[model samples]
Target: MVAPRKYPLELRERAVRMYRTSDPRPQIKRLAVDLGVHPEALRGWIRQAEADRGERDDRLATAEKEELAQLRREVKELRRANEILRTASAFFAGQLDPTRPR
Candidate 1:
């Protein structure tokens, strides 16, 4: 399940738009203060917005990150199931060996 966002989408979008349009491109820290958001958080939001708009390509977009996370989880679950099957096979093989001690 996705966690609830601490800040609303509207606010994030507004912050990014303001940052982009501001004269001289105001510093992240100062803009964050004006917007009542954490500087680092605002910076990350701006970066993500830019990436989504194709203004930046250095980082993964939100959808890509979510997809990557989902794929990673599926891989982890498959690995765990594979390990369980291997152990079960080993145990069953041992049980079927007639020469093995009871």
Candidate 2:
């Protein structure tokens, strides 16, 4: 299950909007203090917003990050299945050995 967000969506949206709509970009630490949010959290929100708007190339957009996470989960599941199959194959091979036990 997804964890509840620390800050409400409306607050996050409003903060981002306030940051974006300013004539001169505001300092993140100051804005964060004004908003009563952590400075790092505000920085991350701005970076993510920029990524979503295609204004930043160094970070993945939200959709891309989600897709990447999904793919990683699938890969982990596949690896687990493959390990199970390998163990089963080994067990069957041992059982089939002609002279092992009676």
Per-candidate Cα lDDT values, in order, are: 0.93, 0.94
Against the hidden reference, what TM-scores do the models get? Answer: 0.80, 0.85
Look at candidate 1 and give me any clashing residue pairs: none
In model 1, the number of clashes is: 0
Model 1 C-alpha lDDT per residue in residues 1-102, reported as the tens digit of each score: 789999999999999999999889999999999999999999999999988888898999888889999999999999999999999998998899989876
Residues 1-102, candidate 2: write the lDDT tens digits. Answer: 899999998888899999999979899899999999999999899899999999999999999999999999999999999999999998898889977774
Report the C-alpha displacement of residue 38, candidate 2, in angstroms. Answer: 1.8
What is the C-alpha local distance difference test score of candidate 1?
A: 0.93
Ten contiguous residues with the weakest lDDT in model 2: 93-102
RMSD of each: 2.2, 2.1
